[model samples]
Target chain A: MTSRLTVVYGVRASASEIKARAQAIAVEQSVEMPLSAIHDGSILSDIVGQVRAIDDRGNGAFDVTIDLAAATIGSDAGQLINMLFGNTSLHDDVVLSSAILPSEMLSAFGGPSHGLSGLRERVGAKGRAMTCSALKPQGLGAEDLGKLAFELTMGGLDFIKDDHGLADQSYSPFVDRVRVCAAAVRKASERTGHPTRYAPSLSGSYTDMERQLGLAREEGLDVALIAPMLAGPSNFSALRRNHPDFAFLAHPTMTGARVSPVLFAQLFRLFGADASIFPNYGGRFGYSLLTCKAIAAGLLGSFGGLAASVPAPAGGMSLDRTPELLDCYGEDVMLLIGGGLLSAPRERLAAEAGRFVRAVADHCYPRLSTP
Target chain B: MTSRLTVVYGVRASASEIKARAQAIAVEQSVEMPLSAIHDGSILSDIVGQVRAIDDRGNGAFDVTIDLAAATIGSDAGQLINMLFGNTSLHDDVVLSSAILPSEMLSAFGGPSHGLSGLRERVGAKGRAMTCSALKPQGLGAEDLGKLAFELTMGGLDFIKDDHGLADQSYSPFVDRVRVCAAAVRKASERTGHPTRYAPSLSGSYTDMERQLGLAREEGLDVALIAPMLAGPSNFSALRRNHPDFAFLAHPTMTGARVSPVLFAQLFRLFGADASIFPNYGGRFGYSLLTCKAIAAGLLGSFGGLAASVPAPAGGMSLDRTPELLDCYGEDVMLLIGGGLLSAPRERLAAEAGRFVRAVADHCYPRLSTP
Candidate 1:
């Protein structure tokens, strides 16, 4: 197996032009010049990406693996990205199916400064799948949402994150919200005697986010709800790398460009996501069952010895789907249900939370009784 | 006429399921639940996105304008993004064509910290199209690429940037490269009396990049070539907003998911980009003439009264296409040719630089003589 493999996966719907598209991706990504010029076999031949193997998965879909010369990516995440999906992403027909990062690159990125095990221990939801929810609708005041989070965690959630839409606004600034919410969760933990953490949204410009991260940490927040697409993957990865204590959960907002759930999950982990959230198969967003499973598999799979991160499948999940998700994902999953829970009667939130936790608990170990 | 309006752009490619898709976008984006469940029609309707108008753009493509409630986005940049493309981006068929941010959102998320006028003044290219090139083919040592950059700047290119492929690699460590390259350009600028600037690639995790930015500033570098997708758009925007003195040049790497150039340019500018570069028509990359033109138009077009940004067309641009580019883009354009100049014989570099600038000068203002 090649140490550096760049998988050129184009969409099945546009597979008629697969070979040409694959070749285009190779040249466009690397040399940014025509391939024919290298026919004379100069240094450019080795420097440019060359398609080594092609596999047709039938049904109009094909996977072409290109062997990128190790020197193609200049040891930085940004350059690696330029060579991966830079220009190709503009084309609707082509989709980046997958790529194997050089072990050195994987080591440099160091997938999720803290992975699944760390998070499982932090939230104290060991021996079963994790549970999380969002303080949502974007416009809630800090106090209102903090109280709501207090109630939910009191009902028993491992970690409560801010919805991707929740950012620093007049109604609820980031520092205020994070501080208030963290206090609420801490108070709830004291009452319930079950540890629950708050992962506030760190969504802003670098300085803005840096301050937010500092505040969250100062207030003893455990994880950060990072919008990788909105924030920039490198920024999040770097922050995660630097701050090893806090855990991270990725939110899927404006990440449609990474079409495949598997690629989405794999890249997120490689870049530094301890927990990546994806749309559930039968839910509102259009991901299929196979793709969702693929995302879960890739997240927990060994990649050049990189640690396995948690795959959190969200978007339109409810209490009823907990059993199915538990069976599918086993223990390495973080179930996120936003509107599914937020839309329920405010009074019934505690009851709903109890049922959700019980379902996951019962499914994880059917041989044993629920707590 | 509302203070906040979210423009909905959908594809003709998936028109068979138009209404359903439109409704899905409205629900998935805001509520993330079945619309029918909001039977009480209480505050949920006010909180959710409401589709106001839908138009058929000739073929199967249609434009649907949805007005999200004013409080949809918190004041922070991430919330705006979540409201814009978020979950809908997962659906391949749904393309975000164009969006309009309300005045308040626009005010909160200021477009470009510095615009066209600021750049022209800084570069001293007072009245014509600016010329720029990359120190590329990543494997070269810091001194080699730095000398190459010095020669290019001495030859008269306005802005010398690191190729997207050039990162903090062993081959050319970022600090070593930035210091050497900036020194080379500074030395050349002293000799030529030309105000050339070196924009190093700030491509690493947060701390890694923060150090690079500080180093570039200390070394008297004017701008930094930032990969928004790689660093996270929010990260770049934050860096740009905080460090207003250093100009930012946006590079298109790992940004293929943003399908439409028009929408791509609009969003980049909205977030914060002094200059936006895209693959040109007839380039090694597959952007069509129409798409490239649309990208240019969008950057220069007045949206929400934002200052105009420079639209740079790059990728496989040869010396021959100079006049046509001048005609198409007129004055406000940054013609970026990477390998076109770098691939030339070392001895001929000075002449090549002169001719490249001369062509743009002659086209922009025929009476002006090439210096």
Candidate 2:
């Protein structure tokens, strides 16, 4: 029985006291702890394991590892993790900094089945940081955006996607926008002999979302751009599990709930985001550099037996920041440059994006060829 | 366009500074206010009207409001409100305490379409305080829970529901469980001529959820219990819209993300919960009495402009505290008592619940009934 071990560390509380409390909690909720001398024959024993760990931050949060002997988590591993967080929520001073779960739980629900490696394989980007662009300034028509996509792929971006706000609005209906943009990207890819994947934004009423997915499929779009917060986290996992072949590029609309300095990074990865885009440290939206670094570590670092994920930092980024970002993020990162590139001249769009990608590649892996 | 006004109250910041920031956001994102005089316009203005009220909360949080004119909230009122909330979210420190909107949004979302009046009319308990009981001791079999439900309904609980944790575990497959329980309650109702309604827990995977609801409908259950956090907030609205005939009872499972003293209550109502169940003050959970009062007040109290909703206080509630709870939360409240009742003897279960309800009813509205 592979279990979740959450190591808690704090002060004003002894390990013995914490252990007693943990055992009590286990008995009160899950299986009873047999090791406790205080254990009575009255309650059912449900606890399978527990242990304490050191916290470098010296924060009041206790790091406790909980062992599950059975398949307590059904299909939705994310929800199960949420329940765990909820259970310990009665205490305020106690912070849940991290959670470790087995890969089986993720595999049980088909979590990130294609991850970064598989996605890169499909996109045919074997090495080097991939350049991605977003078609934005929402008020534009589908044809106008499609023309921009043509130039962007022609310029050098390996991937292009719709901005998170690009819902099925009158400015650009989802199906029409998807058809035009995907075709343009495909034409550019064919001419250049490089696969430039197009991911269209997906957000709407239930029927509308289903229609958007269907239309994307019909148009042969490579990835479906979805904001997990807008479409619901479970919705992303649900869609991904259902359409295993379609690459899920999750956006971050209305994602304020998950960005607290303490819990943001780990929770996002736990919810099964293959690639999560957060407003960078120095970016306009205000996530601290420390927070960004933690998010990167949480996603790419080995923990809970889950596979690594891509941490995409966007929002108010520019070409000059490419080296700095790549230097910080390393090779596994996805450099998403949106409005900054789009605001430039049409011809400069692709060239600037290509330049930015080349700079990142040169900075991260200097041995790799620029072409 | 009855636009949304988001009031963010925090430490005193310059009004011009705040307004400038708001205007910058409006232009950069939505309506496009020029950088020089960006403070003049707001996101709401694009839709309708704008009013920025900034107040210092002594704490670091600032209180600001953006009032939208009626034109902004056109035919798609529900979406209009969502857009309002979404737009303001792009900024920070805007702890949304209230949302002011016209009746059209309520109608569009079919809010408590059948509110307290309609609910009372259906249950045939118009005047007296309603009685409800949750069948629990989570690990029990379906037949055992159904038998308990039968006893409760027969012994005179107005409503019988499954404890929120009673989802589709192998011990109690939802379809078979709902069928047996609904039948048991129906038999009890037939015998006693008491119109006791049953609402079973229905939090499952997307497909399982749809199937569970279909089964609940087939089994003639009056209401379906849904934990918005465990499921999704949109799921509640979508379910209500899809199953117009059925009533939804929303629970606060794994909903701690929004339970901050500032935002929890009002947002729950806006997220479309007819009866929003939260942890009561002085329970095993740790919400302050003031916070609980605020939640209740926010639910029933008139805000900038929002509909009244039922504040359901559950989670580790005991009968001894019923009188105190009733005193704190006046009438028009649903007091959900779970584990305490489950601990009672089978014979005493219904009578104990009825006694508890009678005590609350008597304490709150003495003229109505007494045990």
* Candidate 2 structure quality by residue, lDDT tens digits, B204-265: 54455677888988888758777654555555567766776776676665443323532444
Native contact fraction per model? 0.57, 0.08
lDDT, candidate 1, A239-279, per-residue tens: 77667887888877777755466876787888778999988
Task: State the displacement of the C-alpha of residue B322, model 2, in Å, after optimal TM-score superposition.
Answer: 3.0
Candidate 1 Cα outliers beyond 4 Å, as residue runs: A1-3, A11-20, A34-46, A57-61, A71-75, A364-371, B12-17, B31-46, B57-60, B257-259, B364-371
Please report, in order, the local distance difference test score of every candidate based on alpha carbons: 0.75, 0.61
Per-model TM-score, in order, reads 0.90, 0.82
Interface RMSD of each: 3.0, 6.2
Model 2 has an lDDT value of 0.61
How far in Å is the alpha carbon of B134 misplaced in model 1?
1.9
What DockQ results for candidate 1?
0.47
* TM-score between model 1 and native: 0.90
